[model samples]
Target: MRPRKLILCVEANEQVLSVRKFLLETRGYRVVGCASAAEAIEYLQGALPGSIDLLMSDLQLPQMDGNELVRRAKQLLPGLPALILSNTVTGYDRAAAADAFLPKGACTPAEILDRIRILVARKRGPKKQMPTAEMMPHEMAVAG
Candidate 1:
């Protein structure tokens, strides 16, 4: 069996963090929840390369915002996928560093889960396949 994907979830609110952790865990993801960007950063620094599959953080965080966290995280692990959540739409533009941005209250739990699934799959990249002899010339070209 494939190993469960590890996610680093950062949010200042304990309640939000707990809910997110529960949601992710029940969905078969192994989540490491943190209450602050600093805490999350510390965890990242100690983590081995490719240990964490995704980074999901709240836009509003103590000391540093989610965008900054994503930027720093990318430096530590390039190509790391990040998702930023916010209660308001005003800061969506600022979350450009993130792979995706979701409005907390506006999006339903299902939507959140769908987005997470998409991001994680994107990080895993396209699946490899052997070009079959039956494949057309154009199809083989694309597959290769």
Candidate 2:
């Protein structure tokens, strides 16, 4: 069987954090829930490369907003997939660093799960390779 995906979830609100943690855990994810950006950053810094599959955080964090967190996370783990959640629709415009964004109360659990599944699968998908001269068709290569 495939190993469960590891997710680093950051949220300031305890109730929201617990609910999200439970939701993801029950869906077969291994979650590391943190109540602040500092805690999440510490975890990321100490974690092995490619250990965590995703970073999910709330938009309204106390110290650092989710976009900044996503940016910092990308610096640490270049290709790590990130998802930012917010209670308002306006957060989408500010979530440029995240791979996906969801309005907290607007989305159902199924929708959130579906988006996460898609992002994770996308990250695990085969990478596209640049075509070398030898890989090109004979005619195309000769024409170049």
Best by lDDT: 1
The C-alpha lDDT values of all candidates are: 0.87, 0.85
Model 1: residues >4 Å from true position, as ranges? Answer: 128-144
Clashing pairs in 1: none
Candidate 2 lDDT by residue in tens digits, 11-45? 99999999999999987789999999989999999
10, model 1: CA deviation in Å? 0.2
Instruction: List the lowest-lDDT window of 10 residues for candidate 2.
Output: 128-137
Residue 2 of model 2, lDDT score: 43
lDDT of candidate 1 over 1-144, digit per residue (tens)? 447789999999999999999999977789999999999999999988888989999999999999999999999988789999999789799999999999989999888977887777777766542223234436645655
* Superposed model 2: Cα runs more than 4 Å off: 127-144
Q: What value of lDDT does candidate 2 attain over all alpha carbons?
A: 0.85
Candidate 1: lDDT of 44? Answer: 91
